[model samples]
Target: MSIGVSANRLELLQIARAVAAEKSIDETIVIEAIEEAIQKAARSRYGAENDIRAKIDPKTGELSLTRNMTVVEEVENESQELTLADAQKIDKTAEIGTVFSDELPPIEFGRVASQTAKQVITQKVREAERQRQFDEYKDRVGEIVNGIVKRVEYGNVIIDLGRAEGIIRRADGIPRENLQNNERVRAYIYDVREEVRGPQIFLSRAHPDFMAALFAQEVPEVYEGIIEIPSVARDPGSRAKIAVISNDGSIDPVGACVGMRGSRVQAVVSELAGEKIDIIPWSDDPATFIVNALQPAEVAKVVLDEEDQRIEVVVPDEQLSLAIGRRGQNVRLASQLTGWSIDILTEEEESERRQKEFAERTQLFIAALDVDEVIAQLLATEGFTDVEEIAYVDLGEIAVIEGFDEDTAEEIQARARDYLERLAAEQDAKRIELGVEDAVLEVEGVDLAMAVKFGENDVKTVDDLAGLVTDDLRGWFETKNGERVREPGILEEFNLSAEDAEMMIMRARVAAGWISEEDLPQPEVDETEAELDAEDAFDVSNMDLAELEAEAEALGLDLDEAAEAEKEAE
Candidate 1:
């Protein structure tokens, strides 16, 4: 106590110190208590209209108060209105708006105001303490704490977490998990806040971090340096995919976390209300890695394209349905686990895909046998819309089209052998070149003329021979005119027992950068149809511009004039 302060001031100082030490109250509470006490003392004697105010030196226990008043035209109530005479006693030049306060009675006044002052002081101290608690706890978010369920009230469960009471709203509680009063529960402190009732703490049993916390408790390998959890994705209370990696070569991270008979994972899953847990081994190679992400479903093949961060999974025909899981859960979890987009397909679909693809390649190379509008347009590209056009169309004429050059046109034409002799020689060389047995001769019901023609065209491999248009192949054999030989005929011609051709084309397209492996779409029969149609639409086939130019020149037509005519035709 200060020398000027009475015994009452010393007692108030002791009380302020006790409240300040309560952890919930800071020095603000002490100052507020003293100020309130002094204000109560000033108001008691001077009347409430006096506009009494107070300030207390909390460290020294010194109290001071002023009776606030206005200098009016004439004083009405002496308690709140100061006259020019009263104001001039404190200040000689008291103006119309000036105020003055006289020091009130000291020692006796202090003793008389003690009780009312104490009540006001205690009330202010409580308010400051509540604010302090609200401020202190609000910063401790995302922490795990143990609490006893006090009671469920108004759709919220009040938890006594020892240090403070927290409210677990109904939304944060897992369904069917009954929490009774006095029962101990572990929850994540999701949010600590200030409510009208003071500090409002929010606890959660349904947060994803709750499941993570459970694993941290049950899996020692995860807590230790042996296993590192890279990411956790969950559909809380349903299923979750956790990607984990082994820090040490000797440690099997997935196996360690799974435990014997899945005891370790089962424990965490039980804590999360039977939520399914998928423990996947993390991978550096996204393709091989995605294969591991969608677990419990056998993946036949994984095709990955890194540029798009996509992965395509080919599952066995029987496992396709499971690989995608109920509502696509398997693939969904796989996507979450690898952070990559994924597509799932079956073996049979992939097979039919290859068959359709082989037929298209065959059609692309059979330029001479087919002279339809679209084929004519493509053929016109090489200045060879038909067989007759090819005999005279020169290299420069071929280069005039979009992507063709003299060398490319020659290569295309050389590859497009329509005669039986050329077909046979090419097939013989292809057979020796690929080191595959020549089985086309043994194809039952196949004519000797057709077989000879196939050999002449160097169609040794199923894919190479499959490279001819059905109409052109028909033209070569002269068995049937303009009849299309599609997949069935090509399969028969090559004696192919399996449809491995689709996978091959996909691999080729991927290698060629036409389609990324990760973003492989479901194989479609019309994959090449649009490109073929676009080629057909361009009127470059068989119409050798050079020959047209020569004929026009004979008629005295200029090169520029011919080009203008061609553009107008287009």
Candidate 2:
């Protein structure tokens, strides 16, 4: 592969093939690099202003040099351009874009020229190698790769992944798990990014998916996709939980993952530096899945708050420590696995909470209805949570209560309505005292209670409410001291959904002149709503066939559904 003043240039193709094989790059790239080097050397040999080019015959391994000139109407440089008349003299069919090339004798590279060409070839080959590595590894993210631990630099583990290099940052490695140089290790390819130097591949041993990958390797059912791992939570070298479900009806997902006599799970545990693995069966019902997640501890009850995705789990008093685990690790992992905020309570604590809620409801009923303590207790026992429910409910519902006739129901409803009226009047006065403008109350969903809350929170005018975000009305959660804590909003007691809060804020914005009615965000048409046959819901009469097909596809409506709607329309 030498290129001295009188070296054999015929070995160009052989050199390209050898280099491409060594670097795992295409031979064509190597050949192009050599051609570029030859071009640079030829340019140096000829005058620098000449448009010199070099070409290599891929099959014959032959080299050729030529100087080219482009034919233009107006000649710019005497070296690189010529008038069309001159080009026409060389070739009769010459046009403006025609290029005329004159063959030049091969270059006899001087020592400096050889060195410069060598550097050019080396740089080109290196660039091609890097591009090859990037193309090969970019799509390998989320895959498990095996590599040798090449080195540990400043606490980061560098792995040689055969064709590419991957790094496991200090945080991505399992705790207390040390690796020696040249040791074989398996890791999860979490990310691959292109940098100035080369593609940077990020691998992780502590990622939850790493455990899932290990299980896939150990358990045939997982690899075959018969057993699906829905979620994974890892403490990294301490413990991990994986939720698995079986697509095959006869096979048990947990049993398959556990293997015969724990052999399968033990192999994965050995790989993870003895990390304990919990194989839980996944259920579509969140409560059932959460109960399965808290294994080895019996759950007395599970109450789910579907709107918030929070759960309250009541366990036996003796199983309290087991459910919580050391420093609350078990519950934390369970929350991560189930995507829910879990609050664990013992049966005794749950009983106390129930009694306290009952007492609070009873007290509210007595004061709102101006009833006796016995009547209040009866209303509370009948699940009457709010005075508004008693006021607005059908009289027959109240009369159906034990020992309660229609007359008693009427009296109770009248008192509840009176109490509500007085409360609204008081809230309105309080809002005025707090300097809230009457225009704020003009917005839809802004009742006297919400207006008073707005004033208490220093949002007195419509402009103030318009500037507030939905979180300021529906409340939000923040992480503090490594714990998620709820931050109360001004209208949190109203139990408004995020959509409802946003709508209220938008109405306020419209009323305050900050936004026009047309500027309010439009509701997206639901797929179901768009597929309805009712003309008021959706109209396909004006649409051409192609447009109707596109609309049907956009709504995700099947052909049968669209046909049925069309039939109904017809």
Candidate 3:
């Protein structure tokens, strides 16, 4: 007797096997789903109150329906439980908590029960299919997969990836690349996520790594680890740059990646829809790497600012356009590949900037130090960029300059100090006028000028400053104009380093009682301390005689004599 439709017990197993194979799921899971459907149908056929269960035999494809009743000392619900005496009639050894099964004939499902069973089986199969997809694709992320374009809805392509379906959002697709139904395409499996609806397999053609992976497949050296691709930047269907380094001393990474007569790179370019690929050698030095990244554009000079992770590249006036690319794409990609902000300048621009800086420094020295332009020009030519440098430099350094004596150096430093003091006083007056709170000024690097800027921006309190991140503070100081200018940031105007800004923010946090002393920045150890023997440096209080001797031996110092010398010096 069939429980649903016209199928028999053996046919149920046959259907489950076919579905499991088709869906790439386990046969046991399908069998359990069928059993649940059968149980639901059986309950509908009999009374709903009966404790019904359905089981299917694996080997023989046999189906069984039974009603389970528990044996207890006293039965309040007769349908579910039976007293010991009543159960003993069915089984002489029946005891408390023992379950008794009553076998029932196979069910003859009506049309409504058959429909309900179909729905149950369909729901279970869908859930199983979702689980199968999630399990199969979860580990396949970052792989390149080929699929047929199943359909497109609102510019989103749904790809049929053989065993699963993948989605490529419009933004993830290469620009100007149109996909038609049944068209075979390749994409990177960038993301695989499980959602309430189902497993989502996101594919991308514009990801930077997608191009890198394609090259890795096309180039044998890259695939075999002889050449490593450290970074990649792409503009999708336009241009792409990849930085490659060679492990073997003799192997040329760029030549190997380019293949015989550009075959390897052409393969990648074809895959990327005619996008231009520039294969450049990677360098440990960022300046050299950036120069290499801006190839075919002659670089006159490269000035690196390690503290800011920025590079100023000066190219010939004719090569400026080539260095910047169409709408700055070349420099932008170069910046991304080298992990630095790049500023492109022409030779003429650099020369003009130098002259302007020289004039400015000369004027500054003349005003601050009360010196003639000739003297100011001498100081500027010696690379005294600001008053603080002259004030803090070794006296010999300044006196060595032409026409400057030791007495002249002393007077210059004293004047620089006086000028700084007066500047600080003026800034303090302005800060007070702007109503900046004293607590903000208490932060180590939040001087009078910074405090005034903060007041202008409504960051008047210590808590306000503490709430800011380094980037927020940096952005706060950025000029409102779109034109890029040197020294545009307030931090730069005040000669404050990023570290200084971070320390100031941390100080504000500490002053607001938002953090403990343990969160404070550790004091940097002096170079002399770092040069000491490890035993003496790390554990001075617990040093043994043997360790002390070893330390003195390393330093070529006589322990007793050194102690006597130190005592006499003290």
What tens-digit string does per-residue lDDT give for candidate 2 at 361-397?
Answer: 9999887888899999988899888999999999998
* C-alpha TM-score for every candidate: 0.52, 0.85, 0.85
Model 1, 1-570: lDDT tens per residue?
Answer: 212235466566676787787645776667777776767666776677677877666767766666678888788987678777777787888988986666655544454466666688777876776676667677777677888999999778999877568888988987777889899888888887676767788888877677666777788877775787877777667788888898899989888888999999998887777888888788887776788877788988777756336667788998987888888777877776777778888888877866565445445436444434453455644334244345345656655566567776675445444443465577666655555335444433333444554555665444454344443332222224532223233333433322243443344345445567785446567958866755543232345877876756765668666566556546
Native-to-model Cα distance after best TM-score fit, residue 120 in candidate 1, in Å:
7.2
Residue-wise C-alpha lDDT for candidate 3, range 1-570, written one tens digit per residue: 334433566888898999999999899999898889888887777877778998899776888889999998877878888999988898899889989998988767777777888899888998999999999999998899999999999999999999899999999999999899999999999999999999999999999999989988999999999999999999999999999999999999999999999999999999889999998899999888999999878899999978768789999999999999998889988988998878999999999999999999999999999999999999999998999898888999999999999999999999998999998999888888888889888887777878878877778899998998775565332333533334344354564566777888898999999997789899888887555543353333456888767766776777875565345434
TM-score result, candidate 3: 0.85
CA lDDT of every candidate:
0.67, 0.90, 0.86
Q: What shift in Å separates residue 159 of candidate 2 from its native position after superposition? A: 1.1
Worst 10 residues of 3 by lDDT: 476-485
What value of lDDT does candidate 1 attain over all alpha carbons? 0.67
Provide the lDDT at 515 for model 2.
82
Scored by lDDT, model 3 comes in at: 0.86
For candidate 2, the TM-score is 0.85
TM-score for predicted model 1 compared with the true structure: 0.52
How does residue 411 of candidate 1 score in lDDT? 56
